[model samples]
Target: MQEWFVDVAEHIADGDPIYLACEECGQVALPPRTVCPDCAGRSLEQRPLSETATVTAETTIFSSTPRYAEETPYTIVIATFEEGVRLTGQLRGAETVERGEEVRLGVESDGDHWLITFTPSD
Candidate 1:
């Protein structure tokens, strides 16, 4: 797990927000990809992501999920970036975040890993 976290941090430090690319089809996907759903490609490329986006959807989880008790009722948001990449992550620093709200990327350390968060745009 430590190695995984290190890798993730390194990846984030090297290039972020990462994008997904299909090696077989040479198609560039805005959000990072594990395998190309369109082409079944096993190879992928991680590319830098645009910093700005708009919230498309959001939900707050109040249940006692492990590792997130302090952040219960935390906002989880899906955002579509200016580059047309759609991604989901925790929404931070807002009591209420709504759809179509502008957001920006913020990084948070989770002890084990660094996770991305969306903050309300100023």
Candidate 2:
């Protein structure tokens, strides 16, 4: 899991689009993948992910999860990129966001490490 996080961090730093490549099936998947769901492959290649995406759905979480204690009652969105991959991340720059909103991906440093986030477009 740490290795995965490191890979994501490096990809964000390079400003390159992220993707996952399946070793067994040789399929390139965006948003990264632990395994090839199609072929049940265990080996995966992590690469940078795209920054542009559209909000497919969103909701505000009033209760905090164990990992996101500081982010209670925060808005989270499921964004679908042009590559047809979906990802969930923290939503920023707004008190309220809606479905179909165009957003861009960004990396946020949480003092120790970086995490993905969604920023609303102007």
Candidate 3:
């Protein structure tokens, strides 16, 4: 994982999710960076992320390495927050979801690792 992702993980672990925002262009980045990818601006701020997001895309995984083989048929989702930040996370506690569905963003522990987690909000 990238070092910037660790910062996001830390915030998620603390129950305070955050994202990067370009102070110059107002572009939000989930996997954050020191410089804005959109405008190449150097001033970035860590901003709190919204609790809810809309599902933009989804996929079902049926095959994986041994570590996650048993968790086959799990759903992964790409969601976009109102701030225009997009993130990919595992959809938990829901068997199926649709594009445009609303989800609540969160973090969950999977064994010794922390993962981005999402659940149906509507």
lDDT of 2 by residue, 5-121 (tens): 666656766777577878777776654667787897989866446687899999899988687877687898899887667777789988777799898887777567667788898
Leading candidate by lDDT: 3
Better of 1 and 3 by TM-score: 3
Q: Please give the CA lDDT of all the candidate structures.
A: 0.73, 0.76, 0.85
Compared with the true structure, what per-residue lDDT tens digits does model 1 show for residues 2-119?
A: 4533454455555555566676887767444567877878788765667768999999888966878987888889999765667677898887798999998766675756676788
The parts of candidate 2 lying over 4 Å away from their true place are: 21-35, 40-48, 65-71
Q: Could you arrange the candidates by lDDT from highest to lowest?
A: 3, 2, 1
Report the lDDT tens digits of candidate 3 across residue range 63-108.
8778778888789999999989898999998997999999998887
Candidate 3, poorest ten consecutive residues by summed lDDT: 1-10
Whole-model alpha-carbon lDDT for candidate 2: 0.76
Residue 92 miss distance in model 1 (angstroms): 1.2
Model 1: weakest 10-residue lDDT segment is 1-10
TM-scores, all models, native as reference = 0.71, 0.73, 0.91
- For TM-score, the strongest prediction is 3
Please give the clash total of every predicted structure, in order: 0, 6, 0
With a 3 Å backbone cut-off (N, CA, C), the pairs that clash in candidate 1 are none
